[model samples]
Target: MLKIDSIKFDDEKMDNDRLNNYIKKSEDAVEIFVDLLKMDGQEEVVGMIALDNDHRLIGVLELMRGGDTFQKIGTDDLFYLALRLDADSIILAQSKADGLKVSKEDYQFNEFLIEEADKFRINIHDNLIISGRDYISIS
Candidate 1:
C-alpha cells in the first residue's frame, strides 16, 4: 500500500475531509493542485490526483519535476502506479513558467493519456496547466 508520506507535500497535512470536499469539480481540483505545487516549491512539476470509482480522493502522485520549461511524465510508471493504487480516474496537472498556456506537447500528451486510459480502464478527468495563481484546462 502507498502511504501519503510517499508523496511528501512539504509540511502541510493532507486533510482528507477538506480535500474530498474541494475535489468535486475541476475548479476545486485546480485549487488543490496549485496549493500542492506552492507547498512543494516546484516551478515545474508533473503530478496526478488519483480518485476512486466514486471520485473520492485516493492520493496524489508527484510524477516528475524538471526545469521551468518542461517536465516529462513517464507513462509506464504513471499507469503502473495508478493500477497499484487502483485508481478509477485521474486528473493531471503541471506547473509551467508560461502562465496558463497549454503547449502543443501538453495537448498531445493529454490526448495520449486519454487513449491509454481506455486500455487501462481508467478515466482521464482533466489536464490542467497552471502558472502562478492561474490555470487553463486542456482536457
Candidate 2:
C-alpha cells in the first residue's frame, strides 16, 4: 500500500511565505501539470501547464498514468530533477483517476487544490504569466 498521499497545506513544511508573496489578486498565475511516461524504459515527462485568468502562473503539479502517484513521491523528488518555475502553493493530489479520494483533513493542501481542480485546463506560460517559483526564496 502507498503510505503517503495527502493534500492538506499545513501537513508538510511549506517552503516559505516568499513563494507567493509577489502574487497579486488582480493577476492570476498559470498552473502547470507534468506527466512523465516511461514507455521504453527511458524516462520522459509529458507536461501540461494550467493557467488562470490574468495569466499569472499558479500550480505546477506532476502526473504519471502508471505506478507512483504524486503524493507517494517525496517533496524533493521532482524538484531534484524536473522542477516547474515554482509557486506559493505546490501540491500533490491522489487523483480520482486512480479511484481514490483521500479524506479532507487527512489530505494535505486539499482545500486549495480541490477548490481549483475543476474549471481549469492545462496550458503554457507566455510573456504575460507570472511564476510564483520565480519570486520565492528558500530558507
Candidate 3:
C-alpha cells in the first residue's frame, strides 16, 4: 500500500505539478490501470479506477484507450482522458487553483459536469472538495 506520505508533493499541496514531480521523484514508478467502460451493457475501456503493486490508490490519473499506460510525459495525455470523459473544465479550474504558480501551461481538463461556486472553483459539489487541496489560500 502506498501511503500518502510516501507520495510526496513537489509544489504546493495539490498543485497539478505534483503529478509530474511524483513521476520524477518516486523510486517506484507510477503505473496506470484504467477500467474498460461501457455505455450500458457492453464491454468498454472506461470502468472503475484501480491501482497497481498490491492495489492501493495513492491518487488518480487519466484513462486512455482501453488500457492504462505508464504515464511518463505530457499533460496532453491527461487532458485527452478528461476530454474523453467530458470533465475538462472542472479539471482545468481545479488544477489551476491547485497547481504551481511559476509554472504555467495550456489550460486542461475540459471534461466532467461543471458548475460554479464561491471563489472555490470545484468540480464535485454538495461540499467543498478542495478543502485540503488548496495550495494558495487567498485571503
Higher-scoring candidate on TM-score, 1 or 2: 1
lDDT of 1 at 80: 80
Q: Per-residue lDDT for 5-114 in model 2, tens only?
A: 24233433334532232233222222221121112212322222222443333444434543433345443443322233332233332222222223443343333333
Candidate 3 similarity to native, TM-score: 0.21
Q: What ordering of candidates by lDDT runs from best to worst?
A: 1, 2, 3
Whole-model lDDT values for every prediction? 0.69, 0.29, 0.25
lDDT of 1 at 134: 69
Q: What is the lDDT of residue 6 in candidate 2?
A: 42
After superposition on all CA atoms, how large is the RMSD of candidate 2?
A: 15.9
Model 2 off-target regions past 4 Å? 1-55, 58-61, 68-71, 78-84, 98-100, 103-139
Can you write out model 1's per-residue Cα lDDT over 1-139, one digit (the tens) per residue?
Answer: 2234343232443555334422567766776666664513346777788887877667777776777433445676788888888888888888875456666877888888889889889888777887755677888
Candidates' TM-scores? 0.78, 0.28, 0.21
Off by over 4 Å in 1: 1-18, 39-42, 68-71
Question: Which run of 10 residues does model 3 get worst, by summed lDDT?
Answer: 34-43
